[model samples]
Target: MSLTKFIEEKEVRNLIDNYVDKPKFDLCAEIKANPQTKSYALVGTAFDYLMRFHFEYKYSIIDNCHWVAHNSLVYLLIDNFKLGIEPVKPIAFLTEMNFKDIYNDSILDVKDLQEKLKEKNDYKGRQIFKVINLILNAEKEYSNFLKSGNLTDGVIKATIDLAKIDVIYRRKHYPNDLGEYKEGNIQDLKQLYKIIPDFSKKKDSNILLNPTFDKASQLVGGADCDIIIDETLLDIKTTKSLRFTRKYFRQLIGYAILADISVNIKKPKNLGIYYSRFAKQFVFNSDIVYETDEYEILKDEFKKKANKIYG
Candidate 1:
């Protein structure tokens, strides 16, 4: 069943309107300082930031790497098409095959991108080319859907097709490369590509809420959520399986609590983890839903823990 339908009435347009006066905090700095000492505290910040990028921005920060950049660009392209919206910013492609200086100017042509990918003779180059080809070929297979497709149903078939391709090549090219710093990111694309259509078709506009909330340095610390779809709080886990472990659950619940105290918005009715690699969503409703009791408990726990490190 589509869990999203159950939480429609609980969503609010501006979740932060009531608490505009809250003070802000910059937890990113704390997360960067000697992670060895406060690893647990940092984990929440790190995961929250990563999900914000993946869910809200639809791009990964680690995509700065060339190998990962290819996937990021392709995903961005597909997302734009699926959303029935044009790219908000112009996208640039590398003019040369040199990994260091691959980009020149932003070009929106898929064929031009493919042409450039073909020119590279190196192993990494070939790897990128193959992934791009997978997307291109998938696009061709689903060209029909792209024709009359609204934001609702663009091309889910192509996603499964790409998943079936053997794109995981020998690590001859950048074996040590951390594409998006998340394992199975390339493989997980198949799942993300397939699942996004389901979200777009929902009653909500699928708009991303304030991706970051650095405005709570006063009563509480800074906090952010992954994807605020309508009234749901969704986080993406690129992990191969759905492991709602305590640490993971705490991290998500922390975001919910932070969202409530900092933004004065009612806690989300639904919380979801999109296990991208598995192409499945493990959703939690009333059972694990954030409430004032849980919120106060977590708030005290977080502040106590965060203060130990920050102080």
Candidate 2:
């Protein structure tokens, strides 16, 4: 179970019920989606990638290298070959000839990818292509496309395509199990570009993207949160609804507990949800969740429950 799954347990819900008071906050102005927006999940995931790209472009922060999807997908491809599972469609094509051998030899770790991205002056259009090449083990296939500098539409499409890999990786599904490829709506990118500037204005803030809680994450199988700016832990949501429900509140609280127990560089002083579609963040101080003295008690309870379930 992950942090999300752990929090959803009946016992965990009851624990939250006894502790967390309902948060009261005003909703932000909503930005209506285009009529052509069909894939909400795709857009959400792609926008996440876009936001990371925006951060890297603007602040020169290289932090998403530890993304589980990329690392997990790499492991799955190698494991499938070892098990002699009959690879299908895209996987078969990707692994045909000596590609599997090439993949095993050239698999890049998080550090390697981070260093490579750091060396590039421009990571905006090329990030998704590098990820795709890494996943498919077909650097040659996308080499020309990466060189042509015609990356606008291609980048958006690649972002959505790469987002699809997350589902497969999370479910441990075969690569060929990926559904039909969806074309990315340019309007999604347009919306993202417009709202991103407001969010990125925190120029001097310390930013950590897709941060894990070290051994705390391992306690509940795995958990990696969105961006944490300075002392605030924020989860990016691209949903149209502005409702800050109990579940959402509990998620932020769960992340706080994880951060508290872990040896992370920064501990969150506040927790927030950045509704990307609305381009507004609803932030609440950690004190709002629990009193200073109460937090230690809560953390101990959380660890006990997590150990009971995950151990």
Candidate 3:
């Protein structure tokens, strides 16, 4: 079980119900979505990727290159090679070409791709969209040259062909949802970029991208939080709904307790939900949300529950 699944367990829900309190915040004016927009999940994922890209371009931070698609590809490869299950045509073609070895080797090449992207010195929406696709495609098409003993020209041709198929495959199965991949999603990201505050201006702020709660994450199988600016942990939400639900509140509280127990950076002083559509953040001071005594008690209870459930 992952932290997400663990938190949804009945016992954990009961703990949250008993301890967590919803914070009050004024809602921002809504930025309506395009009528033709299909999948909010894709939009959310893309927006999250774009925000990470934006931060890298705007601030001084090392690229983490923590693409969630890598995990999806790993599982797909395992199913194909280990379990004797056939995947979609594009994926099947990849597996047939001994792409598993390429996939293993390409993990190290993400930094090279990041360097190439940095050389372009362009982080605009179109460039970002293309680069994001390239990264998601695993950046292993070049390995076809060595595998097939093909010349540069043949390798370039094969790479383009493979890339096209890969994009088609991803649009069908990425996030395991049905939706058309549209240019409007990129446009939405551009609009979101306009609203992002310049974190570089903040005094003595430290930014950790895709921060994980070390041992706490290990205990629950795996868990990663979004950007943490200074002492604030922010979860980006691309949902159309404006209401701050109890579900969201509990997720933040869960993360806070995990952070406290994990041997990572200092626990967040505040928890925030950044609603991307409205470009608004609803923040709650950690102290106000959980009093000192109550927070310690809850944290201890959480650790015991996590060990019993996932340890």
Candidate 4:
């Protein structure tokens, strides 16, 4: 399919609808290299609705600021810090910290910081996006003001928004709480998942591959992780049990194998599916964790059996 067609396809809905997910794995899975959705409201029927609506011919595309990836931004920050731009905003609590504090953190004297950075041998004076941090600080300030009272924009009140924040950090605890805990947590994990060791490799054989498993039959593409690489396909899912569902693990196993076949890297020896289960933390004993290699086999065995279903 053409790239545009793939983006607009309604069949994509089948992914979240059919796949299962419920529990969450706390480990920082690597980027393929490691990383880590479904809902059934009427929104689930959106694909059906869109098919019948004859919308206007596309005009200008929506203004989505597809800036650099978060990791890239972070890398730039680190580099800028070395250069003295120090774009890395200190870990300031938003709901707790005020505008004055943020301003101080950003820069007490911009000219002085700039001059010092200019003379430093840190980066040969490359331009940096020092402004983004300022914008984030501003966003945090606005978010904090909004949370000061139940009122929103002085016109509308957002029970849902408040509810989401309250769940993450109660009203008393949430400051500039733009769900930073979750985002910061993801950032903090980048180091923990520095390496993904212990996985096998496989080569692709077009002549030997079952024709039915061609690209046309491949339903999932980049649904998880920043980028899908060989030997590691990270998908986020929520499941009641974290145990192996090897009996019906063919599709995912195929993902690992397919990623291996297509990429030069090691066969994704691991398929990490992350899910969030609401079970109490006290019930830790009930949690199930399966090995990546074990799931790989479960997938191969299931594929052998499910081939009959397709036939």
Which is the leading candidate under TM-score? 2
Residue range 167-215, candidate 1, lDDT tens digits: 2321112222222223233233323444442544444344454344434
Write candidate 2's Cα lDDT for 7-95 as tens digits: 88988887876777767877757575442477787678767766665565556444543444454445443553331222222231233
How does model 4 score by TM-score? 0.23
Candidate 3 lDDT by residue in tens digits, 92-142: 222232232244443323344345446655533223334345443433433
Q: After superposition, which runs of candidate 3 have C-alpha atoms over 4 Å from their true positions?
A: 32-36, 62-65, 82-180
| Cα-lDDT of candidate 4 | 0.29
**Which 10 consecutive residues of model 3 have the lowest summed lDDT?**
83-92
Clashing pairs in 3: none
TM-score of each: 0.39, 0.75, 0.67, 0.23
- Clashes (backbone N, CA, C under 3 Å), per candidate, total 11, 0, 0, 19
> Cα RMSD (Å) per model?
15.4, 9.1, 11.6, 20.2
TM-score of 3: 0.67
Worst 10 residues of 4 by lDDT: 48-57
Q: How well does candidate 2 match the true structure in TM-score terms?
A: 0.75
